[model samples]
Target: MRAITISEPGGPEALVWTEVPDPEPGPGEVIVEVRASGVNRADLLQRQGHYPPPPGAPAYPGLECSGVIRAIGPEVTGWQVGQEVCALLAGGGYAERVAVPAGQLLPVPAGVDLVEAAALPEVACTVWSNVVALGRLAKGETLLLHGGGSGIGTFAIQLGVALGATVVVTARAAKHDRLRELGAAHTIDYREQDFVEEVRRVTDGRGADLILDIVGAAYLPRNVAALATGGRLVVIGLQGGRKGELDLGALLAKRASVAATSLRSRPLAEKAEIVRGVREQVWPLVESGAIRPIVDRLVRMADAEDAHRLVETSDHLGKVLLVR
Candidate 1:
């Protein structure tokens, strides 16, 4: 097998695709012959030496992939070799073959092809867990999202719309129209417009009932101000600086809550739970055409360095996939 390995983390050039020993299944795990893998910002972070894989996880960078089951391990059931599946992986998606926990595997959603299915696991589980499960996004409420043109943002937009919430998104001016087409009730040009003000304006000054933010400390103060009474704010990414002071008085006045989560480092049992929730609640909507995986483009698996360069530019909308 061949995989991308970082001899010394630095730039996209560090992702070297070279021959490596094939992975074998362990207890409650399966070996997947990779067909496609999803590229994410985390992959870039890993390549730059900022993030490392969790203990016992593969050294490669991908967080999700679509593949065929080549072998099943002890204690695995309800799955078989040759099944087409997509998996939520701790690491190792950027490879020809990977060992995956059986619990993290999902059948390819109906109507989605193999390569595109690689786009689902990470974004779907993240959105479903934060927005629906934690934030308790109810019908008839307004949901505010940052990074609206991103892979997670696009998926969240469709999910929010399908769940009957009005969606408001923040992105650059060029991507606003496309986000609106994806069912965002409002779009803010974060480069020029104040998202806190825009969100309030679109929601008739009630503010958003739920906010999903990726810009960490940079947007913390304004995010609190943009919340409605009893609003929930879930922060899933820290693209901005990490530390910031919060106004506890403001939060108390609004009776709001704030939470932060990292999906990659979660325990396997917890990830399995998230994956189950996605399959049960999100997959039906996908199969029904209510939501779809939005892929920006596909690059050759051997050229992962090129994919990393593109992702860093933030020029593409939705996911960039690496295919065999």
Candidate 2:
């Protein structure tokens, strides 16, 4: 099998495409013939040695992939060879083949191409786990999503809107129109406008019922300022610096809840639960076209380094896929 391996853990240039041993499925797992994989910020961090894979995880960087099941492990059931599946992996998704737990596999939705299904697992699970499961965004409420052009952001906006929430997003002006088209009731150009103010204005100063933030500490203050009474703020990434002062008084006054989490590094059973829930509640939405991944570009598998570079530059909107 061929994989994109980190040469020395530095920049994207360190990614080297080379042949490696084929992976065999372990008990309750499956070996997938990877067709495509999603490039995520976490992959870049791992490539640079800033982030390490969880215990017993593969040393490779990719966290999610779409492919066909080539072989199933002895303990696995309810699946077969050649099944078109996309799965959330602990690692090793940048390879021609990856072994994944059967519990983390999801079928390609009705209308999704196999390659596009590669973009679904990570973003869908992230959005569903945080916005839907933790933040508890409900119908008729106001939901604010940061990084509106990101893979998770695009899904969050669509899901938020489809669930009847008034979706609000912060992105560059160039991306604002697309955000609106995706069901954002309001779009604020974070570069030109104060997102806190725009959110407040659109929500009649009551703030938002739920806020999904990827900016980390830099947006912490504004996130608190933009929350409605008892609002929930879920942090999934730290694109900005990781440490900052918090307005304890403000949060106390609004009775807001601020929590941070990561989809990777979670226990397999927990992730499996999330996969099950998403398959039940959200897969139908994706299948019916009410929600779909927003793919900005697709690169060849050998150019995984370039995909990482594109994501690091933050110039592209939505998922950057590496197609096999």
Candidate 3:
């Protein structure tokens, strides 16, 4: 088997696709022959040595993939050797083969292409877990999603709309039309507009009922300002920086709450639960054509450096995939 290994943590150039030993499934795990994998910002951090794989996880960068099951381990049932599935992985999706916990596997949704199914697991679970589960965004509410052109942001926008929430997003000016087409009620250009003011204006000064943010420190104060009374803010990415000072007075006045979470570091059972929720709630949306994979482009697995570059540039909308 071959996997993208970090020769040294530094740049996209550090990701080296080289031969490695084939993975064998352990108890309750399955070995997947990777067809395609989603490229994420976490993959960039891992390539730069910032985010290491969890203990006992493969030393590769990908967080999700779609592939065929080649082997199944003991204690795993109801899955076959040749099943086509997409999996949520803690690591190792950037390989030709990966070992996945059976609980993390999901069947490819009925209406989605097998290769494009690679984009669903990570973003679906992230949005479903945070935006729906934690934030409790409901019908008639407003969801403000930062980095709207991103994989997670794009999915969140559609899901929010599908779930009957009015969706607002922050993205580059050039991406606004596409986002609006995807059901964003309003789009704020972070480079040209004050998102906090725009969000408040769009929501008739009540502000967003739920805010999903990726930029951490740089946007913390503004995120709080853009939240409606009793709003919930879920921060899943620290692209801006890690440290930020909270305005206790503002948060208290609004009765708003903030939570920061990461899927990669969570326990297997927790991830499985999230995956199950996505399979039941989100998969139906995909199958019904209400939500679909938003792939910016697909690069060959051997050209992973280019894929990493595309993600870092933030020029692409939705997911960039690495195909085997």
TM-score per candidate, in order?
A: 0.99, 0.98, 0.99
lDDT (tens digit, per residue) of candidate 2 on 126-209? 999998889888999999999999998899999998899999999888888888889999999898899889988998899999
Task: For each candidate in the order shown, give its overall lDDT on alpha carbons.
Answer: 0.95, 0.92, 0.95
Model 2, C-alpha of 178: deviation from truth (Å): 1.1
* Predicted structure 1, TM vs. truth: 0.99
Clashing pairs in 3: none
Runs off by more than 4 Å, candidate 2: none
Question: Model 3: how large is the Cα RMSD against the reference?
Answer: 0.6
Evaluated at residue 167, the lDDT of candidate 2 is: 94
Query: Which regions of candidate 1 fall more than 4 Å away from where they truly are?
Result: none
Clashes of each: 0, 0, 0
